[model samples]
Structures are given as structure tokens and as C-alpha cells.
Target chain A: MKRGLITALAIAKKDLQTELRTKESINASASFALVILVLFSFAFDLGREELYAIAGGLLWLVFSFAGALIVNRSFARELPNDCLDVLIASPAPAWSIFLGKSVAAFFLLFIVELISLPVFGLFYNIHWTQNFPGLLLVMALATWGITVVGTAFSAVTVNIRLRELMLPVLLYPILIPLLIGAMGTTTALLQGEPMSGEAIASLRLLIGFDVIYTSLALYMIEFILIV
Target chain B: MREKAIYLLAILAALVMIPNLKTVFMDLPDEAMQGAIYRIIFIHVPAAINAQIFFTVSLITSILFLVKKNFVWDSISVSCIEVGTMLVLVNLVTGSIWGRNQWGIWWAWDLRMTSQLMCFLLYLGYLLVRPAIAEPTQRATLSAFVAIFAYADIPLVLMAIRLPNVRTQHPGPVLETGTMAKEFHAPFGLGVLAVFLICTALILIRQHQETAQREIDSLRRELHSI
Candidate 1:
């Protein structure tokens, strides 16, 4: 188990190092997220009450789309450079590879969310410092769940034609429950409401989703890689 | 062909089922809330049941393809998905029509309808993914993985929509269980069973034809090489 964890961490570090050098995926994702935020602000006119009501949902929407795009590109990059094939042929377990990719994606989405929150606050004129910690926690948990499943699906879909288009088609439907839970919790936190029993319930649901999806993805990753 | 005979029987069963469904709809007493047009339950309930049958078949065939690794199973899985997609589309359309009469709108973000739509889209994605890849082995393998993964969403979609907070217009499960249960029991069961058998028979026939065609094509290619 320790060896597996080490392998997973090593794989994640490699992905992070590759991104550090290229900066293609993270930069693209961040910029795309910013643009989406801007578009939403303009589209909704950013009226005070309206903006406050939708801020959580808008931020999550941007993060999810950006996360999808980044996940797709990361796998696509590894495939073309023969990195994925090399990893598959290595001594590491397949679940380790899934873990590494999922962690890398989770971090990338975290960075995007970090940037988008301030941008969202500025454009919508909402305060963030009050809910910062809770929002951060929710984003972390939600991204972990999304990336675990998204990374596996993205790896499979990247080989198909119109892959960029295919990723969202395959992803959004599955991610709806997670999105709802996350968005609901975040909205509650942002409003300074007590994390109601309902909010706590949503958090638990998100955690349950993360556990189920991650374990399932871990088991399935080997089949995905071989096929 | 034997497959054609099974399909013919399936059609005959469907024809026999129409009057039973019609009688149920005609017999429903008027309600203060929904009125006479609410009789659309006969069509809506059967369509929904058929949709579930298709989804179950798709899931089972997908597992079969993974275990058997047979091209026959792969083709059958694909055929079931295609028919399943068709049934779901019909269900959505008819459900929407029913909604219009009962609720004064053509569409509702109802849990049942939304989840059913999600199932439809997932299969559509599966179908789209299959044909785009040219290699047979790769196509089967990739599609099998997708089949497994996509079906995982069905339960989640069902849960999300069923949750009370979602504020959908469709009647709840309680409504289905009460008087509606007795009303729908026979025809609904028959419709589900008839569709299930018909779909299985159709998929088997399609699988046989697909296999035979692939064999002929491969032989032709070998001859050309010679």
C-alpha cells in the first residue's frame, strides 16, 4: 500500500512537472474559466441580487467546464508523447496511474477555482473572505470527485473522434449530481447561512459520491488502459 | 428466418396489447385536478416501462460483451442500445404530450423524464462513439468500456431527479403506487415483457446478420489479397 501511494505520488509529480514546463493546459483552463465568468456576468447583467443568487452556480459551472477541458488535454498530451504507453508498460499498478492522473486533475481544477473565486467576487461585487474556508473545502471535495471520474472517462474518450466535443457529452450527465450537491452547499455557505442540516446532508452526499466514483474508477482504469 | 418469425410474433403481441391499453385509459374516472385527458397514463406508463426494459437490456448485454468478448455479443449490445434509444425517444415525446394535456405545458423538468432523457443521451453517445473508430477490436473494446461506464450514471440520474428538492412537475412514486398501480398493472407488465422479448429477438437477429456480413467482408478481403 505504501508502495502504491508512492507510485501514485510520483506519477502525480511527473504530471505537475510536465505542466510546469509547458503551462499549456493550466493556462488555457484558467483563461477559459475567466472568459466564462466574464460572459456570465455580462449575460446576467450582474445586478446585485441576481449576481449574489447565482454566484455559486456560475463559479462551479466555469470550474467544471474548465476542468473537463484540462483533463482532456492532459491525457491527450501524454498519449502523443508516448508518456502514457510508457507508464502502462511500467511496473506501477494501473490504479496508481488513475490516482496520479486524478490528483493532477484535482490540483489543476483547484488552481482554476482559486483564480475564479476572486474574479467572480470582483465582477459580481460579492464578499468572499467570509466564506473562503468553507468554499475552499467544498471546491476541493467536489473537484476530487469530478476529476476521478472525469480523468478516467477523458482518457477513454480522448482516442475517439471529435474528442473535445465528446468529453462533455460523456461527462456532464454523470457529474450533475455532484454539481448539484456542490452548488447547493456553496450557495448556502456564501449566503452566510448556518450550514443547515440540509447543507450537511449535501456535503455527505458529495463525499459518498467521491468514495463510490473513485473506487469504481480505480477498478475500471486497468480495463480502460488495456482496451 | 427464425429471427424474422420472432420479430413477427413480437409485432403481433404489440397489436394485441393496444386494445387492453385503450380500455384502461377509457375506464379512468375524471378527476378534479387532471380531468379526462389524464387518460394518457395508458401510453405514458407503458412507454416508461418499455424504456426501463431497454436500459436493463443494454446494461446486461454490455456485461455479456465484456465477459464473452464475442463479436456476436458486441453486436447484440449495440442493437439493444439502438432499440433502447428509440424507445426512450418515444417515451420522452409521448410523456411530453401527456404533460401538455395534464399540466398545461409541453415539458417539465420532472425527475422521471429528465433521468430517462439522460439515459437516452448516454446511449446516443455510446452509439456515436462506436462507429467513429475504424478498427473492429478497438471499437468493441472501447465501446464495451463506455457501455459499462455510462450505465453507472442511470442510477445517479434517477436519484437526482427523484429528490424532493428538485421541484419537478411529474407525479411522485406515491401517485404511481396508489390507484394508478392497479390501473397500470396488467398492460404495463405485458408491455414491458412484450418489449423486452421483442427487443431481445430483434437484437439477436441483427447480431447474426452483422456477424455474417463481417465474415463475408473478411473473406472478400482475403481473396483480394490472394
Candidate 2:
């Protein structure tokens, strides 16, 4: 198990090095997120209260869309020169490769989300920093969930035709529950509410979702990658 | 034998269905709070139940296909999803019509409704993604992964209505509460049986077509190679 994790981390480190060299997906996703945030403020001219109520939904919506942009490229980047086949043929197990991609995606998405939160606060005229720890926990759990599913699906769609269209169609529905949990918890935290029963339940649901999907992706990635 | 079973199921479905239609429409009294519009549950609830059942069938077959690497399981899995998608559509439309009457709105974004819609879209994605990948083994493998992933939502949909945090306008199980009239039970029970039999028949027919299509494609490939 330790060796497997080390292999996964090595793969993630390689991906990070490649990403650092080029800075393509991160740049594109972060810029897309910022553009969407600016456009969202223009789209909805709600009052302070209404914006706060929905700030969670708006923020996560940006994250999901931008996250998709990043995750799609996670596997797509391997397409040139048949890098995917080489990666699959390596000594590492398929689950390790899947985990490595997810870990890298988690980093990319987390950075984009970190960038988006303050910008979202700026445009929406809300003070989100008061409950920083709570909000960060919510973001981390939700981002992990997104990366696990997104990376697994990236593998599935990478070889298909019109894969860009196929990825989101295949992805968002599986994400409905996770998004619902994230939205609910984020909304409550932003509203300056205590960790109420509902928020706690939502957090539990989020954690449960992350665990289930991550394990599932680990178990199923071999079937997808080997074929 | 497969053809004979399909015919037998079709006949059984019709026999079970006629009494259900009469009982639901003519014999059962109107629900106290919901009135006659509530009668849609006979169709709606049965479709909803059978849709879940068919999805389960697909999930099983999908796993089998991955394990056995057989095209037959792939065909059965895809057929179940197709029939299941149709049933989910039926459930959604009927639920919408009923909601229009009862809730004064055509749709509600409550947990139950939203999850059911999510299930529908997920399977619809399954169907949409299949034709995009042309290779037989790869298509079967990838779609099986999708089917298994999508089936994870079924438990959530089942439990969505009962979750404490989210507000749901959908009713709990009336049969369990014994609030449904004893007369309503006959139609409801028979309605489920009829829907399942009919759904099974449709799945078999579609599975046959899918297998035949696969054979044709393989033959065409042979012709090209020759």
C-alpha cells in the first residue's frame, strides 16, 4: 500500500512538473473562472441579502465549470504521441494512475477555487473571511469529490469522439448530490450561521460522497484504463 | 423460448393490466385530500418502481459484462437502460401532471424530483455516450463503467425524500402507512406486476435487436476485411 501511494505521488509530481513548465490548464481554468465571476455579477443584480443567500451556489457553479475545463485536459493532455498507452503500460497499477491524476486535479481545482472565493466576495460585496476555516473545509471536501469523479470520467471520455461534449454530459449528473451538499453547506457558512444540524448533515453527506466515489473510481479505473 | 417468454409476458401484462385500469379508474374511490387527480399514482408509482428495477437489471448486467467479457451481457445491459430510460420519462411526465394539479406548479426542485431527474439524465447519458465509441469491446467496457457509476445515484434517489434537511413535497409510501384504501391495494399491486412484465418484455425485445445489430456489424467488418 505504501509503495502504491508512493507511485501515485510520483505520477502526481510528474504531472505537476509538466503543468509548471507549461501552465496551460491552470491558466485557462483560472481565467475562465474569473471571467465567469465578473459576468455573474452582471447577470444577477440582486440585493445584498439575496446575493449572500446564493453566493455558495454561484461560487460552486464557477468551480464546477472551471474544474471541468481542467479535468478534461488531465487525460486529453496524454493523447498526443500516445502518452496514455505508455502511462498505462508502466509498472504502476491503474488505480495509482487514477489517484495520481485526481490528486493533481485536486491541486489545480483547489487553486482555482482559492482564487475565485475572494473575487466572488469582491463582486458580490460580501464578507466571506469571517468563517474562513469552515469555508475552507467545505471547499476541500467538495473539490476532492469533484476531482475523483472528474478524473475517472476524463479517462472514460479521453478517447471518445466529441469528448469535450461527452465529458460534461457524463459528469454533472453524477455530481448532483455532491453539488447539493456543497451548495447547502457553503450557503450556511457564508450566512454567518453556526454549524446547525442541516449544515452538519450536509457535510456528512459530502464526506460520504467523496469516500464512495473515490473508492469506486479506484476500483473501476482498471476496467476503463485497461480497455 | 425467448420469443415464447415475451409472448407469455405480454399476455400476462394485459390480463393483469385490464383489472388494474378498471380498479384504478372505476372502482377505487377518490383520495380524501388529493381527489381524483391522485389516481395518476397507479401509473406513476408503478413506472417509478419498475424504472428502478430495470436500472438494477442494467447494473447487474453491466457488471457481468465487465467480468465475463461477453457481448450478450452488454446487450442486456444496454437494453435495460433503454427501457429504464423510457420508464423514467413516464414517471417524470406523470409526476409533472400530478404536480400541476396538486402543487399549482409544473415542477419542483425538491430533493426527490431533482434526484429522479438526475437519474434520468445519467442513463440518458449512458445511451448518448454508447454510439460515440465505435469499437465493440471498448464501447461495452466504457458504458459498463458508466452504468455502474450511474447506478450509484439510485440509492440517493430512493432516500432523497426521507432526508431530514431537504424539504420534499412528495408523499411517503402510502401502503406502508396503511392510509391507502384496501381497494387501492389491488390495483396498485397488480399495476406493479403488469408494469414489470411489460418492461421485461420490452427489454428482451430490445436485447434481441441489439444482439442482431452486433452480428450485422461484425459481418460487415468481415466483408470489408475480405
Candidate 3:
């Protein structure tokens, strides 16, 4: 177990180091998120309230879709050098690899969100002072939920023929529940509401999703990587 | 023998649905609130129920396939996907028509409707992912896993849907109350039975064709080896 954790962290470190050298995943993700935010801001050019009302969904849209891109690239990056094979052949369990890859994805996405959210706030004139801590909490939990499923599905679709196409098709549907929770919580936060019943319900849903999806992924990763 | 039973059931299902349609239109009075627009219930409710049952069957067969490593179980799962997806599409269209009549909107993100849509997407994803993986065994395992995963998360998704039940457009569960009127019960019972029979017959027939196709593929491979 101790060695498994070490192997997981090592794999995560290896991924981050490779990312540092290439900056492939993060650069693409940040730019894609920015573009989505820009386009949505333009499209909702009608009124201020309308923009504010949709910012939560728009922000999450950027995160979710760009996050899918990051997941696709991270695994595709492994294919050229066969690093994923090496990782699997190592003394670590496949679930540990899932953990490692998910950990790396979490940070990669966090960096993108850190850069993108402020721009979103600026464009939409968001008052970050409204439940900022709760907003941060929502982003963390929701991103974790996304990362957990994204990492597992990245592995699942990496070997398919239409590998690029398969990732989003398989993933986004499963991510709907998470997106609902994240969007609802973010909307509530943006509206300057206290953690009301609906917000609490959405939070609990996110927490539930993170637990269920993570455990299921861990349980199922070994089966997924059977090839 | 299974094929024969399937054909027989198919004919019986067709026969039953004839009266089911008549009862819905000519005999049963319009629902008090929605008027004649509620008559779509004969088609919509039966298809919706069958779609859900088909999904559950897929889930069950998928679990059995995973446990037993049986190709026949996978065939059943695949058949369920095809039939279930088609029926869910029907449900969506019928519900949309009814919604437009009732709510003056083509679509509303209600819990039941949205859950049905999500369920449809999950099944569609399963079908889309099927052709991407080339290896037969790997495909079976992966698809079966997807079926189970979709089934397992359904309750969670339903709970998430209902957490903020802002739109209550569709009616709640009917069979659960067990207080349904006798006049309403008879035709609905037949409608439900007809749809189930049709679904079963389709799956069984498809399962046979799949088995035969597998055999032919194996024969082609054998001839090539010779």
C-alpha cells in the first residue's frame, strides 16, 4: 500500500515534469477555456443580468470541455513513447496509475481554472466577494469529480480507433450530474445567496459524485486496462 | 424453439396493441386536465416503460456476461441497446409533443424528462463506443462494463435530478400507488404487456441473428486458415 502510494505520486510527478517540459496539455486547455469564455461572453451580449445568470454555466462549460481536451492529450502523450505501457508494467497496480493520472489532471486543470476564472470574472464583472470561500470549495469539489472520471475515461478511450471522438462521447454524459451540481452551486454563489438548501443539496451531490465515481473508477480500472 | 416463441410473441403483441390503440382512442375518456392530448399516453407510457425495462435487461445481461464470460449474454445486451434506444427516442418525441400541448413548450428540463434524456445519451454513447474498439473480447468487456456503470449511476443521477425538482411537468409514478381505477387499468395493462412482449421478441430474434452471424464469421476465419 505504501509503495502503491509512492508509485502513484511518482507517476503524477513524472506527468507534471513531462507537462513542464512540453506545456502541451496546459497551454491547450487554458487557451480553449479562454476561447469558450470569450465566445459565450459575446453571445450573451444582450444584458448584464443575463450575462451574470449564465456565467456559472459558461465557466463550467469551459472547464468541462477544456478538461476533456486535457484528458485526451495527457493519454495521447503517453502513446508516442509507450510510457503508459511502462507504467502498467511497473510494480504498481493499474488503479494506482489511475490515481496518479487523476492527481496530475487535477493540478493541470486547477492551473487552467486559476488563470481562466479571473478573466471570466473581469468579463462578466463578477463580484468574487460573494461567498468566495464557498465558490472556491465548489470549484475544488467539482474539478475533483471531473478529474476522477476524466482520468479513468482517458485510459478507456486512449486505445480506440476514433480515440479523440470517443473521449467526449463517453465522458460528458457521465459528467452531467457533476455539472448540474457545480453549475447550481456556482450560480447560487454568484447571486450572493447564503448556502441555502438547494446549494447544500448540490454540494452534497458533488461530494457524493466524487466518492462514488472515484471508488468505482478505482474498482473498475483494472478491468478497463485488461488489454 | 426460442425463435419460434419470439415470432409467436411478436404476433400476439401486434394483436394486443390493436385493441390497446382502440381502447386508448375510442373507449377511454380523455384525461380531465389535458383533454384529448393525453391520449398519447397509450404510445408514450408503454414505450417509456419498455425503454426502462430494456435498459435494466441490458444491465442484468451485462453483469451476467461479465461474470460468465458468455458471448450470448453480450448479444442480449446489444439487442437491449438497440431496442431500448429506439423506444427512448419514441418516448422523447411523444413526451415533447405532449409537453408542447400542456406547457406550451417543446422541452422542459424536468427531473423525469431529463433523466430519460441522460439515459438515452448513456445508451447512445455505449452504441457509439462499440465500433471504436476493434478487438472482440475487449469490446465485449468494455461495453458490458459501460452498461453496468450506466445502470449503477442511474439512481444517483435520479437523486440529483430530483434534488431541485423545479419543474414537475410529468406525472409521478402510477403503478406504485396501486389505487388505479379499474377502467383505466385494463387498457394500460394490455398496453404495457404488448410493449414488453414486443421488446422481448425483438431481443430474442436479434440474439439468434447475432449467434448465426458469429458462426458465419468464425467459418470465414476457418476457411481463410485452411
Best by TM-score: 2
Query: Between 1 and 3, whose TM-score is larger?
Result: 3
Tens digits of lDDT, candidate 1, B1-226: 8767777767776775666656555654565676776655555566667667666766777678777777877777777777778878877887888787778898878677778778888888888777776656677777777777777777766655553376767666534754544655676566666566666667667677768876886788889899
RMSD (Å) of each candidate, 1 decimal: 2.7, 1.7, 2.2
Best-performing candidate as measured by lDDT: 2
B39-76 in candidate 3: lDDT tens per residue?
77777888988988898989999888878888999899
- Calculate DockQ per candidate and list them: 0.50, 0.63, 0.65
Q: For candidate 3, lDDT tens digit of each residue in A1-227?
A: 88888988998998999998989889988998898888876676657787667768888989998899888875677787787688678779988888988999998998899899889888778876678899889999999998888888787788889888888998888888889889978987888889989999999999999998888888888877766
lDDT of each: 0.77, 0.89, 0.85
Off by over 4 Å in 1: B1-5, B11-15, B18-36, B162-164, B172-176, B181-184, B209-226
Arranged by DockQ with the best first, the candidates are 3, 2, 1
Candidate 2 C-alpha lDDT tens digits along B145-173: 99999998666544433444556677766
On DockQ, the leading prediction is 3
In terms of lDDT, the poorest run of 10 residues in model 1 chain A is A41-50
Q: What is the TM-score of each candidate against the true structure?
A: 0.90, 0.96, 0.93
Candidate 3: where are CA atoms >4 Å away?
A: B171-179, B216-226
Least accurate 10 contiguous residues by lDDT in model 3 chain A: A41-50
